[model samples]
Target: MPDGLILPIANQKDYIRAALEAGKHVLSEKPVAKNLEEAHELITCDTETDWRKNPVHQGGFLLDGGVHYVAGLRRLLESQPSSKVCRLSSFTTLLQSHLPPVDTINAILKLESGVSGTYQQSVGTSLTGSEWTVGYEHGVVSVAGSKVVVTVAGNTEVNIIEDERTGVPPVVRIWAEAIAAGITVKDLEPEEALADLEVLELMLRSGESDGLSMSCQYQHIVSNPN
Candidate 1:
């Protein structure tokens, strides 16, 4: 497939490796890999264990769909490690009978960029369309349904995107455009994504295992992206 894109639907590590070996770029789903070991295998590079601090809060959004949100926030701010720190404080609760081992979570994340926010997530709640709200120092931008609401300074504004598909976001379109223009997609590169995976895995470890529970309960299972 010349002049084509390889979108890896699942079996992420193998698919991504094949695409890269074939000289193609990949846009993979979140979490990158099943676990830190598998993720490292996908990267084919040595990643360091550099912890900024000890565990402050530790928990998971079921099987770490938290990765998606965390990755978004990091990319939105172009988060760089070794200088920027993400401190996570997490608490878990069980509300549904058939939920993941760790279902509900509330996390307070303080980024070194002076961006502090709370993420509340649950597999126990009613499933609505996904919503992402980014708050910068100036104001905030929130996307709900097909509408984007921006509140900055002393004013509020809303823009409705006609015929928008929730599953395909503008970011994907930007990626495609960059590829078409023969420009490098910097942030979504494999190495850059590995950085996100590193932080997310650390956060998951700290929050889920309390930085100590891996001895007995670290069962590796393929996560359902529901």
Candidate 2:
């Protein structure tokens, strides 16, 4: 909660910690917290319910926020029986003003079987595109603008072409299903999300050091999950 907003604590660290301690499922704003430690604790905790903290919604980007990309990754990983993430990459833009300013850049995530491509924005012209593409062992998955397309190497091309409108679509619905089924549902589970946060932290740190490689260490300690 931010100071003036009647939000619990403006510091994301405090907000997330309190939410977990209270055993309340949460759907937070994007860029979950200010740092990785807060995000890590929020995600890694062995909670008994589903909690979502995404800045995209809070930032007013609607469903096209960070949630979409993470959800997509989760879908690919779960649907593929033998798939794993190999590596991931992201690209961002500093020049966005026409629409939402997506402070977070692009991401390229590599799965054991292939790669996942994601682009996000906060403020850019509607004409500017925000898309996601996944390359799997069997085929390729591409989501451009409001359309989703999938093509398998030898299988028939099943095109899921539609318009983007209203609340959660297939992406968020997946998480909803997991929750309804009493399953611990999280796109890039807490720990994994924290890992991604740390990766971003390292990237920023490295950039600050003129692209010189650097190490990231977490100082906020959590009680053992055991």
lDDT at 138, model 1: 94
Candidate 1 lDDT over residue span 65-88, tens digit each: 666655555655553442243466
Taking all chains together, each candidate's TM-score versus the true structure is: 0.62, 0.52
- Model 2 regions lying over 4 Å from their true place: 1-10, 43-71, 77-93, 96-127, 135-139, 152-158, 161-183, 186-189, 195-226
Lowest summed lDDT window (length 10), candidate 1: 48-57
The Cα local distance difference test for each model comes to 0.56, 0.47
What ranges in model 1 sit over 4 Å off? Answer: 2-11, 22-25, 45-65, 79-85, 127-140, 167-182, 210-226
Candidate 2 per-residue lDDT, tens place, 1-226, comes to 3121124323655665666666654545445554565565665553533343321122234222444455444544556543444444444444545444334444444444544444343444445555666665688777765566778876645455564564335535665565567565444245544543454544333333444533434312232221
Q: Lowest summed-lDDT stretch of 10 residues in model 2?
A: 54-63
* True-vs-predicted CA distance for residue 10, candidate 1, Å: 8.9
Q: Model 1: C-alpha RMSD to truth?
A: 10.0
* Residue pair clashes in candidate 1: 58-207, 59-207, 59-208
